[model samples]
Structures are given as C-alpha cells and as structure tokens.
Target: MTTFPIYQIDAFADRMFAGNPAAVVPLDGWLPDIVMQNIAMENNLSETAFIVRCDPATDGAEFHIRWFTPTVEVPLCGHATLASSFVIFNILGFDGDLVRLQSESGILTARRDGDAIVLNFPKQPIVAEDIPATVTAALTDAKPSATFRVASRDTDFVAVYDHASVVRDMVPDMSVLGTLAERGVIVTAPGDKPGIDMVSRYFVPAFGIDEDPVTGYMHCVVAPYWAEYSGKANVVGYQASKRGGIIDCTVDGDRVHLKGNAVLYLKGEIYLAD
Candidate 1:
C-alpha cells in the first residue's frame, strides 16, 4: 500500500471558501494517470494538482506537477500550482522559499512571498484574428474589441473588451461553451479602476470546468497583451469569475511575472489501498 498527503487549498483567498479551491496531493511516486483523474473527479473542485517526486534541494526540486479536472488533465493551472507550493512549504515541513516544477506546459517556478505565492510563467504570444462563430455566440451582448489564439495543448479563444465590468459580470452559456474547445475561453477587458489595469474570466468546457478562480497560465497571455496596450511592463490584474482573485503581473519579453496570494485550507494523508 502507498500513502500520500492531500490538501484542499484556497488559492487567491485570504481566508477559507472565498477564492478558488484546488486539491493538492503530494506523492512520493507516480500514480496511474487514470487514478489521478478519478481523484480530481471525486474532489469535484475546479482543479486538483498532484505532486510526485519532490526534492527541495535539487535544481528542479519542487516536484513534478500535473493538474486535472473532473473531465480531463490540463497542462497548466494557477490556483493548483499555488496550492501545491503552499502544501510543500507550509504543511510538508519544507523550508524553501522557491519551488520549481517539471510540468506538461514546461518548467515553471513558484516562490513564497509573505502571504502569497508568485509564479514565473512564459507569456503566450498573441496575434490578432477575426472573431469566429465559436466566440460570437458564447458572449451574448458585447462584441469583442480584439481576438487572439493560443494553441498550446488545445486551441484557446482570447477575447479582449473595453470594460472590466463587462468581463467581471459576464454569465456565459456553459452548454454552448462546453462544445467549443478543450481548453475553454478567456474573455478579458481593461478595468476603469486607476490602479487596476485589466480584468478577466476563464471558461473551459473542454476541460469540464465552468470557470477557474485564478489562472497562472493566463498571465502568460494577459500580461503581454495588457503590457503593450497600457504601454508598461507591469500590470495589475483581477479575475472576476464569481470567486474572484487578485493577480499582479508584468511582461518581460516572452516571459511573464505572475504574483498572487494563497492560503492553505486543509491538509492530510492519502492512503493508496493496494
């Protein structure tokens, strides 16, 4: 029998039940991919990240991180990444200030900063495209100001608008959304708030998630777009998907700086009944 540690962490939530919740499971060895997917489905949360093979002292010491949802495995996940790092540093007795991982998306890093976990992610390059039928019907009232495509693991739809309120208060037709893509849709806009440069939401029916709380991979895309539009490298961002989050980001060439806070909610062990 094999046993592992499991955690229910609230990412971007300063307190319990306020931000997005992702399950973090620490494993010493690999678990069957099917089992990991099953665990995520059982958790029924937006995302659950499994960490196997950790070595804090090694060059890539944090762990090999993977994210899963009720329906599928994802290459990148922000809240789960934060939750995983929190469990490693705070709950698992690791004292390291920085965590790095080998993931599907590529090499990623997370650092402990007082109350939050900041992530260093690659910026997804954006090139303008005409809004397609898949995008036009998903959003009801407003037409997108600009559009971009991210064809990493799956083709993603990136929509930008003029107002954050529109982005913040959007209610999508999940039934139609679910049929669109495997990666979901990201609709964003510039906020009127002086200090806040951008606001956004993520909808992924392809991944079987209606919405995501705080997406780390998103900064990879949002940062560069906002950086150019705002004419600054730094950006103050917010994800207004029901359970909102605060993300501070900046663009550096093809890389992005994603800074955000995370809180550990529950911690325990997982026994593999063998």
Candidate 2:
C-alpha cells in the first residue's frame, strides 16, 4: 500500500463550512493521471489539487500544480490553488511568503497577506455575447440585461443580472446547464451590501459540479467585468452559494489578485494499492 497525505480545506472562507471545499494532495513525484482522476472521484468535491515540487536547479517555479474534477482535469482552478498554497505555507514549512506554481494555465503565484492568501492569476478575457435562449430558460424567469463569454482556455458564460437577489435566489436546471457548450455559467450582479462590490453564483453541471459554493476562477472573469462596470481597480465579490464566501479582487493590467481565507477541515492519509 502507498500512503499519501491528503488535506481537505475550505477555500475562500475563514470558517470550516462556509466556502468551497477542496482536497489537496502533495506528491514528491507525479502520479498517473488515472490515479489522480480516481482520487478526485473518490473525494467527490468540486476540485482536487495535486502538487509536485519542481527541481530547484532547473525550474523557476517552486512546484507544478494540476487540478481535477470528479470527471476530468481542468486548466485552472482558483480555490484549489489557494487550498494547495495553504498546505504549502502552513503545513510544509515553506520558507517564503510567495510560492510560484507552474500549471497548464501558466505560471501562478500565491502570497501570504496577514491571515489570508492572495492568488495572482491571469485575467480571463470576456467578450459580449448574446445569451442563449436555453441558458435563459435554465436559470429563471428573469432575463439578464447582458451576457458575455469568457474567451479563455476554461470557457464559460457570464450573465449579468440587475440585482443581487436574482443571482442569489436562482435554482438552475442542471440538466440543461450540462448541455451548454461552455464549461460553466456564471451569474452575477452588483452587490447590494456594503463593502461588497459584486455578488455571483457558479454552475458547472458539465464538470460534474451542480453548483460551486465559492469559485475562485470564476471571479477572475467577474472581477475584471465588474471593475470595468464600476470604474474601479478593486472589486470585492461575494459568492452567494449556500456556503457563502467573500473574495477580494484587484485587477491589474492583465492579471487579477484574488485574496481569501482558507480553513483546514480534515487532515488524513489516503491508502492506495501500489
């Protein structure tokens, strides 16, 4: 049997059950892709992050990271990246405040910001698009005023609502959502509360997630959109899932800094047949 350390963390939250939960596995070497996929399926979470330290003499990044859903691998995952960083910074006795990771999405960085971890990710591109009738019907009776498609490697649709309640109270049709061409759909609106600039909900039935509690990658899409709409460089987002979370986003030229807190929920070892 091969024993592997595994950590379950609630990302984008200060408490145990208030954010998106992700499983993080730190590996000395890369595991087989099928093995990683099976582990993610076993965990049955929105995402699982796997990390392997890069050779210090040859690589610029401290580690190489990848994210997996229950069914497939993803190009970028924000919450899981944050969770992985939490383990690295807190549990692994890493030396620095900033950790660089090489991923399919490109180079990503996480830094300590007092009690929170800030993730620096590439800003996903957004282009105005016509909302599909199927998407409109799947969400709710209320129509979105504007819609856009994230033209990045991880494609998703963004629907802009007029009110936060519309994004919060939605009970989307998962079966219909699964049929969309994009990876997922993000519904967002201007925040109704003080200190929160935007509010959002994420649905990705196609990725085996009916609803993501707190999505870090989706914020990369929404933060820039809201920044443009609000005419501000910083936008604070609230994900209105049942287990809600708050993310602070700062939009730079081509990057977005996502800041949030993570809490450890479970720490154990996974035993697998070798």
Candidate 3:
C-alpha cells in the first residue's frame, strides 16, 4: 500500500471557512496523469494541487506544480498555489521565504510577506470585446456596461457592472454558461464599500465548478484593468461568494502581486494499494 499526505487549506482567508479551500498533496515524483485527475475528482474541491519535489536544500527549493479541478487539469490556479506555498513554507518548514513552481502556464513564484503569502504571476492581457448575447443572458439579468476578454493562460470573458450588488446578486444559468465557452465568465463591479476597490464572482462549469468561492487567478486580470481604469496601483478586491474572501492586489510592471492568508483545515493521509 502507498500512502500520500494530504492537507486541506483555506486560502485567501483570515480564518477558517472564509477563503477558498484547496487540497495540497506533496509528492516525491510525478504520479500518473490519470491518477492525479482521479485524486482531484475524489477531493471534489474547487482545486487540488500536486507538487513534485525537484530538488531539496536549505535555501529555496524548486518544484513542479499542477492544478486539477474535478473535471479538468487547469493551466493556472491562484488560491491553490497560495495553499501549496503555505504548506511548503509553514508546514514543510522550508528555510527560504521563496518557492519557485514550474507549471504549464510558466514559472510562478510565491514569497512570504510577514504573515501573508504574495504570489508573483504574469499579467493577463485585457482587450475590449463585443458583449455576447448568450454570455449576458447566461451570466446576468441585464447587459453589462462594458465587456472584455482576459487573454492569457485561459480565456475568460469579463462582464463589468456598475455596483457590487449587481455582481453579488447574480445567479447565472450554469447550463447556458457551460455551453458558451471552454472556460466560463467573470462578473465584476466596482466595490460598494470603501477600502474595497472591486468585487467579483467567478463561474466555470467546464472545470466542474459552478461557482468558485474565492478566485486568485481572475484577479490577475481584474486588478491590472482596475489599476488603469480607476488609476490605483494597489487595489483591494472582495469576492462575494457564499464563502467570501479578500485579496490585496498590487499591479507592478508586467506582473501582478497577490497577497492573502491561508489556514490549515485538515491533515490526513490517502492510502492507495500498490
């Protein structure tokens, strides 16, 4: 029998039951792709992260990371990445503050900032697009004031509303949403509360997640756009999901810095027969 250590972490949260929950599994070597997918399906969380150790040392170590949803292997994932870093730095007791993770999207780095973990990710390109009738009907009740496409690791259509309530109150027709795109849509609005620059909700039926409680990937695009739109270098985003979370976003040149906290919810082992 083979046993694997598993940890469930709530990322982008200050406490339990707040941020996005992700399962992190550390591996000495790569497992079969099918096996990893099966593990993610079994976890049934928004994301499950698998990290294979490439080298071990006292300083920063390198690892190969991949993210899988219940249905598909995603190129990039934000909250799961944070959880993986937390496990490496806090739980695994890595000596250095930085961890380099090589993924399908590219090389991504996570660094410890006081109590929060900050991820350095490539900025997504945002371009104006004509709002699709199907997307509008599937995502919201009314037409968006403006629409854009997040062209990067994954293609996500962004629908911008005027108020945070509009984004918060939406109940998307997932059936229609699933059929329209390979990924899904992002519904966002200006923050209703002061100190909160923006608010958003993410849906991706293709990934087997109807709605993500908190998303770090979407903010890669959302933050930079808001920086240019609202003329703010640093912005705070609130994800108004059922289990809400907050993100501290800073847009640097060609890269975005995402800062959030993660808490360990459970630690156990998954046994497998050899």
Query: Residue by residue across 199-245, what tens digits does model 1's lDDT show?
Result: 98888877877888778777678878888988999998888876777
Q: Which TM-score value belongs to model 3?
A: 0.96
Evaluated with lDDT, which candidate comes out highest? 2
- Candidate with better lDDT, 1 vs 2: 2
| Residue 218 lDDT in candidate 3 | 89
Top model by TM-score, which number?
2
lDDT of 2: 0.93
TM-scores across all candidates?
Answer: 0.92, 0.98, 0.96
Candidate 1 Cα errors over 4 Å, as ranges: 54-59, 151-154
lDDT of 3 by residue, 5-68 (tens): 9999999998998899999999988889999999999999999999988753532448889999
List runs of model 3 lying over 4 Å from the truth: 56-61
lDDT of 2 at 168: 88
Estimate the lDDT of model 3. 0.90
